[model samples]
Target: MAENIVQRLRDEIENGIVTNQFAPGDRLDEMQLAKHFGVSRTPIREALMQLGAIGLIEMRPRRGAVVVEPGPHRIYEMFEVMAELEGMAGSLAARRHTDTDRTGLLAAHARCEHSANADDADTYYYDNELFHHAIYTASHSSFLIEQCTALHRRLRPYRRLQLRVRNRMKTSFSEHGGIVEAILSGEAELARTLLRQHIAVQGDRFSDLVATLSQREAHSG
Candidate 1:
């Protein structure tokens, strides 16, 4: 029962943050949240700690917990590193993937395509995440897989928002095809390059994110 309360509180807080109900820098009052949810402060504290671990909140001495949204610059820096990590994963996958990995990757890709064709961005986002994780596992490096998954969680909200951009799903699916082809053909360099581009935040996609952030900030302000 306590564990369930913690999970429920965590999801509530996460949903509030992602939906802009709790703006960046907004302080989270434990007492108020506990009262609102008819729970004890223990679960609220645990939920906040979990959110902090995922980069969605900051916990400070005396100041309590505050929501945090990574600024554009920070997000770009993260994506820059993500591109390199993804590139390495792609190159390694091309060389190291087993038949089992190929089967999983292809299955994940098909699911992503299905979601995209249905124009279900939410479903596509989740499927897209599975597809990326499949590539990460294909790398056959436990440490690399852990690192990629952590960063992926940290960037989850932004990545989900990016899918809402017009026609972005179709474009992302096409890029997935290129990546799949390169990895399957064992073209390490091509796989690396394609994955890097696929993960990197730039061009119109970057612009779209900036606009979205600006609008959210404006509304929050």
Candidate 2:
């Protein structure tokens, strides 16, 4: 029951952060969260710690917990590293994936397609995560999978923000198709390049994120 409460609280807080209900720099009061969720402060504390681990929140002595949304430069740097990590995963996946891995990738992509068709960014974000994890698993390296998954979770809110941009979901779905084709064709270089481009925050996408973050900061201020 305690584990259940922790998960529930964690999900609620994550959803709140991703949806910008809990904006950057907004302090999270444990007592208020506990009261709002009808739970004890124990679970609320656990949830905040988990969020902190994933880079969504910062827990400071005396200051409590607050949102830690990255600024434009920091976000770009993170995305640059993310692109390289994903590129490595895609390259290995193209070279080492089994037919079973291909099947799993296709299945994950189908879910993403379903979510995109429905115009549900939240659901698409969930399925989009699955799609990327499928790629990492197909890389056939336990360490690589663990690393990629960790970074992916850490960047969840920003990635979720990207999907909220106009028609970004559709574009993302199409990019996924290119990546899948490259992987299935066993074109390692192509797969790596495509995945890098697919994940990188560049051009108009970076601008979109900048505008979004600026607006969020203004609202929070």
- TM-scores of the models, in the given order? 0.82, 0.85
| Model 1 alpha-carbon drift over 4 Å, by segment | 1-21, 30-47, 201-207, 215-221
| The candidate that achieves the highest TM-score relative to the unseen native structure | 2
Tens-digit lDDT track of model 2 for 1-221: 88978977887898788656888989999999989988889999999998999888998778899998666677677788889999999999999999999999999999999999999998998899999999999999999888898888777767876788888999999999999999999999999999999988433486676677668878887
Error of model 1, residue 196, in angstroms = 0.6
Q: What would you estimate as the lDDT of candidate 1?
A: 0.87
Candidate 1 lDDT by residue in tens digits, 24-113 = 889999999999999889999999988899899998788799988676778778888888999999999999999999999999999999
Which residue runs does candidate 2 get wrong by more than 4 Å?
A: 1-26, 37-43, 202-207, 213-221
lDDT of 2: 0.87
Residue 137 error for model 2, in Å? 0.5
Q: Candidate 1: deviation at residue 61, Å? A: 3.6
Deviation (Å) of 36 in candidate 2: 3.6
- List of clashing residue pairs for candidate 2: none
Collision pairs in model 1: none
